[model samples]
Target: MNAPSGASGYDAVVLGGGVAGCVLAARLSEDADRSVCMVEAGPDYGAEPRHWPHKVLNARALPRDDVWERHTAVHRIRARVLGGSSCINGCWNTWGSATDHEEWVRAGGPRWSASAMERHRLRAVEQMGLRAVPERELSLWARAALEAAEELGYGHVAMAAPGRPGFGTPLINAVDGVRWNAAFAYLDAARQRPNLTILSQTTVNRLDVRTGRVRGVELDVDGRRETVVADTYLVACGTFGSPALLLRSGIGPADHLREFGIRTEVDLTGVGANLSDQPGIFVPLAPTPDLNAALAAKEASGNLYVSRMLIRAASDLCPDSSWDLHILPSAGAPLFGSLPPGQYEAGISAFLMKPASRGHVRLRSADHSEPLDIDPAFSTDPDGHDIAVLRSGLEIVERMAVSAALKPLAGAAQGHPSRDLSDEEIRSRLGAYWHPVGTCAMGQDDDPWAVVDEEARVRGVSNLRVVDASILPTVPAANTQLPVLTVAEMLADALRTDGR
Candidate 1:
C-alpha cells in the first residue's frame, strides 16, 4: 500500500481511474513534466487484453455484477476497473443534440456551449476509435425492429452520427468484438511514462482539506490507511462517488454535516442535490419462428450478436427541442437474468432522455464505506411531465410491436399484454437507465445550488476540481460515456493551458 517508490507527492492526484480519470491522467501526463498519480478503487489490468476478465472484454452486453445497489428502485451499475464504467457499458457512443450543450451554456456559460465543446468531442471520438456497426452485421431481430419503426412513421432508421439525431445503428466504442474501454484507448499509450503512476485497489477515504485548500487525500489501500499529497486534486470518481466523497469530507450542507458529527468545511448545499437520470421501461416481445431460427443459425456459426440500433424521437411534450425519448431495440433480452435460459426475446427499452424530475444523493452515515442513499424520485415531476412523455413513448412501442414489418416477428409483450395500462400503471413500473448526473452541478456565480463553477472547481474549495458526469448540469439526450469523456478532455486542456 506504500507509494509507488518516489511517489510521495505529485503535481496532480486524480481520484477514481474511470472514464474521465483515464482521459485526464493520460492527457495531463503527456506534458512529461507534471507528475500524475491515478488511484482506482478496482483492479487495473494494465493495457493488455489478456489481463482483462471475460466479462470486461465481452462487447455483447453490459456486465451486471459490478454495481451500486440503489434501494429497490434500480441498481446503479458502474465498472470498477482502470477504464471505469466504459469497460462494461453498452458501448453506445452518442453526442446527443446541440440543444443539450446549449442548455449547459445557459447553466454554466458559453465555455460549455456546443460549438466550444466540439473539439474535445472530436478528440475523444478519435482516441476511442468509435465507429458505427455495419448494416450487414445487424441481427435478424434488429433489422425487423428498424423496419417496423419506419413503417410506424418514425422515419428512415439510419445510423446515429455526430450533430445529427434520428433512428439508426448507434456508433459504438468497440474494436472487432472487444469493448474498447478508456484504459485501452487512453492509458495504454501512456503507461510507460515515469511521471504517471496508477495505483489500483486504492479507495479514497476523503479529501484532506485544511484551511479551504485540499492538501491531499486519505486512502484505504487493502484496509491499511495511507495519505497521498498533491498540489492539485481532481475528483473523477463519477456521479455517485464524487459527491459522496465531498459530503464525507464535510464539504456539503452545513446542517447535513452537523447531523453526521463532521464539522463543516465548505457548507456547499448543492454537493449532493439536483440528481437526475433517465427513467425507462422495457417492452418485451416473444420472438417469432423466423427470428428464432435466425438466432439459432447465428449462434451455431459463432457470429457476433450485435444489437446497436436506437431510435431518438421527440415526444409531444418537447417538440421544439431535440428528441427526448430513446427507443433502444435489442435482439435479445439483455437485462441480466430477465429471461429464462432457452427463451429468446427481442425488445425495446424506451427512455425519457430529458427528464424534468429531480432527486438527491444523501449520506446514510459519515462512513465512506457505507453506501449513500440514492433516491432518483422517478416519475415524480410535479407537473407530471415525465409520465406524460413516457406514456407517449409506450404508445409508440405498442404500435411498433404490432406493425406489419414486425408483427410476425414480435409476439405478445411479456408484462403488459393489453398495452392499455393507465398512466399510473406506467409510473408504477418506471426504472432508471442508470445515467446519473448533476449531483455536483456546474453553474454560474451567485447560484446557491451550484457545487462547482464553469471551470469544474468546487465552489468553496481551492485546488480541488470535479471532472466527471457529476458536473453535468443536465443529463444529455444520449448515453453518458461520450459526453463525459468530452468534458474530461476539455477540462484537461484547460488545466494544461493554465500551466497548473
Candidate 2:
C-alpha cells in the first residue's frame, strides 16, 4: 500500500521502523484516539509473508551481505529493513538474567527494575511467538553439542524461559522455518488500523527542535524533502542510528556539534558515549569423520545447518553474579563465512556477555547521508577486565572441545594464523557478537553523560524520546532482540499511563 500523501501532524512519530519502532508504533496506536506514523529507511514488505524477501524469511543463514558496514571489525553489521537486525539475525531468543534488569534499575530507577520489566518481557514473548525448536527437529550437530555439554555436567537448561539459566538448546523466534521478525510479529496486526501510517523508504534527516521542544522531524522522502509534524517524536533507530540522529539534530556534545558548523541544541556529552558490546572469539574445530558424515546426512535431509544450543555461564571474574559468558556452536564453518570446500568444520563462538570495555559513536560530518564513526574499542578496558572475561570464555571453549562426549566428533583446533598462541595472541583475536548498546544511555539528572531519563525522555528536551538499544545503560547478558522489544513495550506502557 502507498503511504498517505503529505504526511503531517501525527500524535506520535516513530522514526526507524525497527524492532523497537515497530513495537512503539503498534502499542501507541492501540489507543485509537492517537495518530501514529512509522518511518523506515529501508523497504517495507507490508504485513504479508509472501511479500517479504526470501533471504529475510529464511531463519537459517544471516543475510549479512545486505547490511550497512562500518569500518571497525568488531562493530560492522546494521540491518536497514523494516525489522532491522531482527530480520537478518541469528534467531536466538535469550532474555538474559534478572540481574541484567537489576543493573538497569541501579543505573536508572525503580521503574526499570526486574519486577517492573517482567510484564513487558511476558508480553514480548507471547506476541513474538518465542519457542524452542523441538528436540525432534534439532540438527544432528546441535544434538551432539547438547550431549557434549550434558556430559560435562552443565545439563539441559532453558535459555529462553524467564529467570531460568543453565546449559540448554537456545529458543528462537522462529516458527516452521520462517523468521518471526518484529515487523511480522507486532506491526502486521496494527497496519490496518486507520490511526497508524507506515512510511517506507523514508529517511529522517533530523528532528526539528525549537526552544527545547521538538515540533516535528525533517525527512528525505522519495528524494523529496519534507517536514513531518508531531506532538512527540521517538528515535528508535538502533544504537548507531539513534545517536547519529540526535547528533544531526544538534542535540549532542556542544564541541562536537560546533566543530561541524551546526548550532548546538543540547550540550549532552553522553549522546554517543558509553558504547558496549559482547566481545567474542570463534574457535574452529576440524570435524571428525563420524561427525562429518552425520552433518552431510543431515544436510541431505533438508534441515537447517545452524545449531540452536547455547551455553551461558559465569566466569571467575563475576562468580557471584549471573552468567557472563555465552558459548554458541555452529554445525558448519561456511555458515559464518567462506571455508575450504569439502572441509567439514564446526566452531564454538564464545562471547563475554557482560563486557567491561566501553566505546563511542561520533559523527564524521553533519550530513545525514554519511555513516557515523563507531568505535566499539573491543577489549580495551583500562583494568584489563574485558580481556580477562574473554580469555576465560576461550578456556571454557577449549575444555568443551577436549571433553569426552565431544572427543569422537572433534579433531584438531584451528586458530587464526596458527594453533599455538599466547594470551595476548588470543586477545588480538577478539571480535564482537554485533550486540551494541548504551550509546544514548538513560540515567539520573545528576549524571553528566545521561542522555535520557528513566521515562526515556531525552534530557534537556521536551516531547523527544529515544526508545531503542541506544537507551540501554548497559548491554544485556543475551541476544538484544528480546530486551529491546521488552524495553519498547515498557516505554509504550509508560506513555499510555501518562495519557499523552
Model 2 CA deviation exceeding 4 Å by range: 1-7, 70-74, 319-321, 339-342, 414-420
**Candidate 1: where is the Cα deviation over 4 Å?**
1-7, 68-73, 156-165, 304-306, 319-321, 338-342, 414-419
Q: Model 1 lDDT vs. the true structure?
A: 0.82
- Which residue pairs of candidate 2 clash? 157-167
**lDDT (C-alpha) at residue 409 in model 2:** 81
116: Cα error in model 2, Å:
1.6
Cα lDDT, model 2, residue 18: 89
In angstroms, how far off is 238's CA in candidate 1? 0.5
Q: How many residue pairs clash in each candidate at the backbone level?
A: 1, 1
lDDT of 2: 0.82
